[model samples]
Target: MKKVLKVIGITVLSFIALIIILLSFLLIKNYLDSKKPIIEDTYYKNFQSDATLEKKYAGLGSYEVSLVKLKSEDDTIKEYKIWYPTELKSKSQAYPLIVVTNASNTAASVYESFFERLASWGFIVVGNEDKQAGTGLTTSKTLDYVLELNSDSDSIFYGKVSQDNIGVIGYSQGGAGAIRAVTEYDNSNKYKTIFTGSAAYSLLAKNMGWEYDISKVAIPYFMSAGTGSSDDSGEDSKTSFGGVAPLSSLIVNYDGIRNDVFKVRARINGAEHGDMLTRADGYMTAWMLYQLQNDEEARLVFIGKSAEILSNSNWQDIEKNN
Candidate 1:
């Protein structure tokens, strides 16, 4: 009887332990699965190749449009706008590609000024529209769009685009999208670099309680927050709590990872979110150029201008090594 009682007690404990372990595993798996975004099959088929792209574009000049379809392994069509130089260096020399995720969410026309400058400076500027958004923007649902554009069948883009030398520039929601897309995808370094302005850090998405994760990002990211963009706590209290603005605090407070990260500039004094894009500041141009092409002159320009835009003392610390 004593032996039987001891055996029964051991069996009960083992069963309880097994149940607890199984429950913990299910909970953990659920959490991780929630973080991953689903890339649907229909979305992949929308991509158009170079031959099909040239047919779609019917013009030629210093500024001509080229369409690129990022067809995923699953056959999804990811759309992109390729802005090529009016003249190539030579048939053999491929210009570096710059992928700009403009925050304006406007038509390509709205970005003419910035794109023109990039082209004049010798880059093949490309832009993508976020899902269900304006031209040249890309959304969280459309991240594979970026991946396919840099794929192997993209032979036309092979010699045309300088290695995977790519840069992503985003304004507003696009800024947040740029970071989130790369973080979730984990290919920023594999490509080249990223730049953002007047960023919306997806804190609102996470806090409002979505399962998006921007913390695990591994890339060289640069953010330029405008001077008056920070919402006061009182103002934040009165405003709706679920929008993108509330998340800024999350970004300011969180310090998960900062590998290949640099806060190149945080413009000060009357610098609204949109103004930074239009103005042809040497540093703004330089930072993009440096990140995209490793140009020393551009790096010098960024270092010099960084001091002026950065208002926070903390940012000063980040600026020192950058």
Candidate 2:
């Protein structure tokens, strides 16, 4: 009896030790992952090679990029990071602007390459270091601040921001913030379009007090999520709708928007929640180009029977009411 009991105790101790080791490994892995950039060159290369639109817009654009930081006196407004064309100061024409909202626990710095890539496309991209940007308040204020800079002669952006051409984008929590930035704020009407990647679903958003009414979105809206397990909640028969911004949830938001309003929702075939931030860069950039810059080539990707995105195997469950 003593030998049997001793063997069982040893087995249990070994199992507990194994569990601790596995937990420690996972924690260490997560820490390392947080330190790395979400977008990897190999992944981007593979994505760009898969489709025409992705090949065209996924690469860096023609403009040389420059970055600037604006420190604030207000504690809530930590700081703002702006990425733009280096030639903006020498150009005579005002450039379009894009406001970016940060995901939960992620600052603008984590997405530096993304902003730089967007800026290379000739737009001024601005983001604040607000980790909890799901509220949209910081995003709205950042837009106002940039507009103020556009009017200040001492500012580099003075008279150089195309007031009529502005867009906003967000990822994860920032995605929820992007919707609110265009619907909940006084300057809501100022944004001509909005985009979100892996945005929190309606139920999760409400539980977190980041709820937004998609029906209130009057501007051109494009939203996307991933089909990976991380995005799946596994609570429903529609497994695609289980994750952070599952297909079911996306459908709810899409259907809520008026039919006349330009709205789209799609999910990357195998992309995880975090991957959505940069995995769908091609379509996101093309959407901005079509809406904000009126680029005909970009328009081809979203409109007409030959829409490139419609045929891309890397994407699934695409829905657009044009």
Number of the top lDDT candidate: 2
lDDT string for model 2 (1-322, tens) is 9999999999999999999999999999987876676655334455544687778787788999898999976576688899999999898799999999989988776667888888888899998778899989999999999999999999999999999999999988999999999999999989999999989988778778899998899989998999987775656624334678877888889999999999888889888987877788888999999999999999988886678888999888999986
Q: For candidate 1, write residues 112-203 as lDDT tens digits.
A: 54555455566777654333121222433333344454464535544456755666666655556566555554444444666666555454
Give the TM-score (vs. native) of candidate 1. 0.57
| Model 1 spans > 4 angstroms off | 1-79, 131-158, 186-189, 207-212, 229-254, 259-265, 279-282, 303-320
Task: Record all residue pairs in model 2 with backbone atoms less than 3 Å apart, i.e. clashing.
Answer: 231-243, 232-242, 232-243, 233-242, 233-243
Model 1: ten consecutive residues of lowest lDDT: 52-61
Against the hidden true structure, what lDDT does model 2 obtain?
A: 0.87
Candidate that scores best on TM-score: 2
lDDT of 1 at 39: 25
